[model samples]
Target: MGEPEAARAEAALTTYEDDKLKFKVQYPSDWTTSTGETPASEEILGGGARDLFTISPPGANARDVNVTIVATPAGADFTKMGSLGDAYGFGYGLVVPLNKPRAKKGQEDRIQFAELIDSVGKGDYYKVEYKFAKPSTGINSIFFVLAGLGYDGRVSHLYTATAQYPRAEEDKWRAQVEAIIDSVVYPPTIYG
Candidate 1:
């Protein structure tokens, strides 16, 4: 038997390129794109991210359904960590503290589930799936993330792409979201 038609068919996709960062990715053709520096809230995390690229669904805000890529300098500490799991742990550690203070009233924002889905090229890249919930806001979002390490000649960097959407819409958007994350392409000359 052959692969399912749905799997074989490709969706309309548009490419987003960062000439300065030497990276590019393909997203849904109808999605909107934006670029900016890391927000101040993220600046405390190990000197902060160097750049951010966001892709949001048509007529939707990033908080609703989006894919975000954060590029940050991978210092000695990150290089020393040595594994995809460790990298993920390091990033998650930074996020938890930030979310703690934002929790509503008596409710806590927490990770309902997390899994290290896969890795490629001996830890050059990794994929993860996790569920986070803000009980007070009644929001349960599912996240699909891809993290990779690259060296941009002068410095090493970590590029993480996160795709998030409400859990209730998973059945409708999971495949497309996964496709977007999987389509990410880093500079061939920079990444090993």
Candidate 2:
């Protein structure tokens, strides 16, 4: 009665490539794409992202139903961070300052859950999942993040892909979000 499952899935996605960021990914065909310079507040490792690319579902704001990718030039400090697990810890610790100021008095934002999903390429790339609860809005957001290292001849770079959506819709969107994350092809990297 309908298209085959494989065909239907393929037809629902569109591919995006960033030459400067040197990465490729597939997002839902109905979603929109935006590119810009990443803000200092979004920097996780302190190296600061050189560029940012975001894919968002229709009618969704920047903070809702979006996947963002940032490329940061890997410095000596980043190299010394060791495994992907260690990097996640170091980066998440920085979230306090970023969140504290925006926290409301009665409804403080907090991490509901966090876990290290897996790593590939002998720790060169990793996958993690976390949930952020916003009691102010009475909504919980689930985040799926992919992190990896890439080199472009002269310098090394850290590229992170983060996908988030309302936890209430997890049953409806988790697979699609995971598909988008898994579709990423990192820039000139041995791992990914």
Candidate with best TM-score: 2
**How well is each residue in 38-105 modelled by candidate 2, as lDDT tens digits?**
55655464545378899888876657788998888775445522543464564465333333325346
Model 2, global lDDT: 0.70
TM per candidate: 0.71, 0.72
Clashing pairs in 2: none
Candidate 1 wrong stretches, greater than 4 Å:
1-11, 39-46, 76-123, 188-191
Taken over the whole model, the C-alpha lDDT of each candidate is: 0.69, 0.70
Model 1, 88-112: lDDT tens digits are 5655653454344343555454423
